[model samples]
Target: MDNQRRGFPKRCQCGEPVVLKTSTTAKNPGRLFHGCPFGRDGNWYHTFKWTDTSMVEEIEDLIEKVENIDGAAMTLQKGVNACESQIDTLAMETRVHLGVVEKEVEEMKMQLRSLKNIVGFVMVMVLFFMCMY
Candidate 1:
């Protein structure tokens, strides 16, 4: 039986349509099989595959497909986790940079205030010198 074979048997190797029939013997009673009517005619070469075997092969194939899908999903989840980690790192870097920029802006404001004071004193001295003259 081929594990890759999917679904039930539709036709036998003898080019005859398969039929589902139950066994009625002491060795294996009430067992189901998919076989051709010609297969039961006391022929040496006949198709007599068990329905249970085909079902088992089909189930095996479905299990393999499910396992492959699960593996792909795990890979995608790992990629998503990596992207989230990178985003967190960038966010932290941006916060640190913003803090540095704000401090620089405050320092510039203080320097401007000092320059204004110096200019006001220079203007007063010029006025006093002119009054003395």
Candidate 2:
């Protein structure tokens, strides 16, 4: 018999379909079983069955698998967050290094301009001396 059929009783003593309810206790957390709704009023004309131990065990196993998957997802999220943080830090460092390089390039351009002016001045002086000679 299937776990669902075994776990769920077909009919109550009152000729109604048994309602499924989950056990909330520590020993049977999330365990699915059938109960007679009419039995809630302390009537003795109700049926009960907890012999579907395989179904409860299967449910517990599935719950554990889900919890493991959730844990893995959390771990993966943390790794992604760490990678993002590292990327941001590296980007900031790269920006700072680029700024320094840009400043150095500008200074080199200024020095080259000064050197060109000095060379032009020396050439003019040489030409003037040659013209006199």
Candidate 3:
């Protein structure tokens, strides 16, 4: 059973209140744990999880969370990169469109200059013919 998911034991499965105690066994001397008062040493029927083991499990869960966050971050980074690429493409397109508009403006300026010269020459010829008559 995953006792780690259950977290710190408040009550035993046997419907008895758990209390903190120290292990007196040779294998685990002075180890703190929570268990029912009715629980016996080396008994598997009762809840008797080691405190240190529970903490280790907690740390493992945190590591898994960090890994999940890292994966999410990587996914977000990919999205940002795609957005940047799209922006670059749009910028290039804009520059090309602006260049075409600028060329048209230059052409219009040259046409305006030619029209002005033709108008000035016609006005001078009209005045000279009127004076001759």
Native-to-model Cα distance after best TM-score fit, residue 16 in candidate 3, in Å: 17
Worst 10-residue lDDT window, candidate 3: 1-10
lDDT of 2 by residue, 9-126 (tens): 6788789877777777799888765777776535657855554664666677689889999999999999999999999999999999999999999999999999999999999999
lDDT for predicted candidate 1 compared with the true structure: 0.84
**Model 2: residues with Cα > 4 Å off, grouped in runs:** 1-54
Residue 1 in model 1: shift from native, Å? 6.7
Instruction: List, residue by residue over 1-133, the lDDT tens digit for candidate 1.
Output: 4433355778777888889989887887999988788886467476776789778877888899999999999999999999999999999999999999999999999999999999999999999999999
lDDT of each: 0.84, 0.80, 0.87
Better of 1 and 2 by TM-score: 1
* Cα deviation of 112, candidate 3, in Å: 1.4
Give the TM-score (vs. native) of candidate 3. 0.62
Best candidate according to lDDT: 3
Clashes in model 2: which pairs?
A: none
Ranking by lDDT: 3, 1, 2
Off by over 4 Å in 1: 1-5, 9-50, 119-133
Output the worst ten-in-a-row residue range by lDDT, candidate 2.
1-10
